[model samples]
Target: MKRIAIDMDEVMADFTKKHLALFNADYNEAITLEDLQGKKLRDLRPHLVDEIREYLKDPTYFRDLDVMKDAQEVIKELSESFEIYIATAAMHFPSSFTAKYEWLQEHFPFLDDQHFVFCGDKSVIKADYLIDDNVYQLERFTGEGILFTAPHNIHEDRFIRVNSWANVRDYFLK
Candidate 1:
C-alpha cells in the first residue's frame, strides 16, 4: 500500500480559523479569510505579527483547534486503501508537542500513534504522497505533493490543489 503523509495544521485542523479568532478578539480587528487570500496572517497584519507568534507558543493554541471540516471522515475512509500518516511540524513551537499530540489523539483516535510524526522538516517524511497546506513543505517532498488549499496558499499553483476534504477523497479514492 502507498503511504500518504497528511499535514495537521491548516489541512487536517482548523488552525487559521482559531488563529484569526484569537487575534481578532484581542486586537479588536475583523480580519476575514478574504483578507488573507494569497497572504499569510503576519503579511496581512504586519503590525500584529509579534502577537501571532505568541499565539502559537501558547500551550492551548494547538490543543484547542477544531478539526477541519470533513477531515476526520475523509481521512478515515482513505485509511482503508492508503497508508495514512499525520505529519506535523511540531518542533517550531516546543510547547506544541504535547498539545498537538493530544489534539490528534482526541480528534483522530482511529489513527495509530505510531503513524504520527512530530518533526521540524517534512522533506524527511517517506511517503508516496504528501497533502500539505504549505508549499514550502511540498516543494521539498520527494513524492507527489498535493496542495491542501488554505487562505495563505489560495494563489499557489505549483502543485495539485485540493480545496476541501471531499476534494481530497475524490483525488485519491476516486
Candidate 2:
C-alpha cells in the first residue's frame, strides 16, 4: 500500500480560521478572511507577533481547532487503501505537541500515536505522498506532493491542487 503523509494544519484542521479568530479577539478588531489572504498571521500583523506567540502557548490553541469539512470522511476512506500518517509541524510551540495529540484523539480517534510525526521540519518524512497546505514543506519532500489549498497558497501552482477533501478523494482515485 502507498504510504500517505497528511498534514494536520490547513489540510485537515481549520488552522487559518482558528488563527483569524484568535487574532481578532486579541486585537478586538474586525478582521475578515480577506485581510489574511496570501499572508501568515505574523507577517500580516508584525506588531502582534508577541500576542500570536502568546496564544500559541495556550493549551486550548491547537486543541480547540475545528476540523476541516469532509476531512474525516475522506481520510477514513483513504486509510482503507493507503497507509496513512499525520505529519504535522508542532515543535515550534512547546504546548502544541500535547494539545495536538489530544486534539487528534478527540477528533480523529482512528489515528493512533504511532501514526503521528510531530517535528519542526517535514523534510524528514518519507512516504509515497504528502498532502499539505505549505509549499515550503512540499518543496523539501522527496515524494509526490498534493497541495491542499489554503488562502496563503492559492497562488501557488507548482503542485497538484486539492481545494477540498472531496477533491482529495478524486485526486487519489486516479
Candidate 3:
C-alpha cells in the first residue's frame, strides 16, 4: 500500500486561525484572513514578528487549535487507501510536542500513535506522497508533494495545490 505523510500545522490543523486570534487579541489589532493572503504574519507585520514568535512558544498554543475543515472526514477516508502518517516539525518549538501530540489524539484518534513523526526536517520522510503547506519542505521531498493551501504559500505554484479537504478528496478519491 502507498504511504501518505501529512503535515500537522496549517494543513490538518487550523494553525493560522488560532495564531491570528491570539495575536489580534493580545496586540489589539484586527487582521483578517484576507489581509494574510499570499503572505505570512511576519511578512505582513514585520515589526510584530517577535510577538508572533512568542505566541508559538506558548505551550498551550497548539493544544486547542481547530481542526482544518473536513480534515478528519477526508483523512479517515484516505486512510482506507493509503497508510496515513502525521509529520510535524515539532523541533522548532519543543514546547509544542506534547500539545501537538495530544491535539492529534483528540482530533485524529483513528490514526495510530506510531505513525506520528516529530522532527526538525521533512526531507527525512520517506513516503509516496507528502501534503504540506510549506514550499521549502516540499522542494526537498523525494515523492510527489501536494501543497495544502495556506496564507503563506498562496502564491506558490511549484507543486500541486489542494485548496481544501474537499479538493484533497477529489484529487485522491475521485
Candidate 4:
C-alpha cells in the first residue's frame, strides 16, 4: 500500500482560529503568527513564548481543536488505498506532544497510535506522499507533496492551491 503522511493542523484540523484565540487569551492582544517572520509558530515573538508555554499546559487546549470540514470522510476514503499516517509540525513541542497524540486519538477515533508520527522535520520521514498546508514543508517534500491551501497570506502562493479535500481526493485518484 502507498504510504501517505498527512498534516494535522489546517489539513485535518482547523488550528488557525484556535491558535489565534489561545494567543490572544494569553497575551491579552489579538496577535497572530502572521505578525512574525516566516509566519510560523516557531517565529513568534520571544515574549509570546511564555504565553505559549502556559497555554499548552492545559490539556483541553489541544483536545478542543476542531477538525477540518470533510476530514473524516477524506481520511477514510484515502486510507482505503493508502497507509495513512498523521504527521504534524505541532508535535515538535515536547511538553504537548503526548497530549496532542491523546487529543488526536480522542478526536479521530479512526486513527490509531501506529497511524500517527510526531516530527519536527517531515523531510526525513519516509513516505510515498505527504499532504501539508505549510509551503516550506511542501518545498521540503516537493517530490511527494499534495499541498493543502490555507487562509494565510504568506503561504497563499506556495501551496499547491487546492480549495478543499475533494480536490485532494481527485488529485490522487487521477
Rate residue 149 of model 4 by lDDT: 68
Q: Residue 45 of candidate 1: its Cα lDDT? A: 80
For candidate 4, lDDT tens digit of each residue in 37-128? 33655356675666666665665666678888888888888878888888887654566676678778877788768878888877877888
Task: Give lDDT tens digits, candidate 1, residues 20-98.
Answer: 9988999899999999999998997888788889999988889988889999999999999999998998888988999
Superposed by TM-score, candidate 1 places the C-alpha of residue 102 at a distance from the truth, in angstroms, of 0.9
**Consecutive 10-residue window with the lowest summed lDDT within model 4:** 33-42
Whole-model lDDT values for every prediction: 0.92, 0.87, 0.93, 0.74
Q: Ten residues in a row with the worst lDDT in model 1?
A: 44-53
- lDDT, candidate 3, equals 0.93
Off by over 4 Å in 3: none
| TM-score of every candidate relative to the true structure | 0.98, 0.94, 0.98, 0.76
lDDT of 2: 0.87
- Candidate 4, RMSD to the unseen true structure: 3.5
lDDT of 2 by residue, 28-95 (tens): 87777777677777887788788877877887788888999999998998988999999998887877
User: At residue 71, what lDDT does model 4 achieve?
Assistant: 80
User: Cα deviation of 131 in candidate 4 (Å)?
Assistant: 0.7
Clashing pairs for predicted structure model 4, backbone only:
none
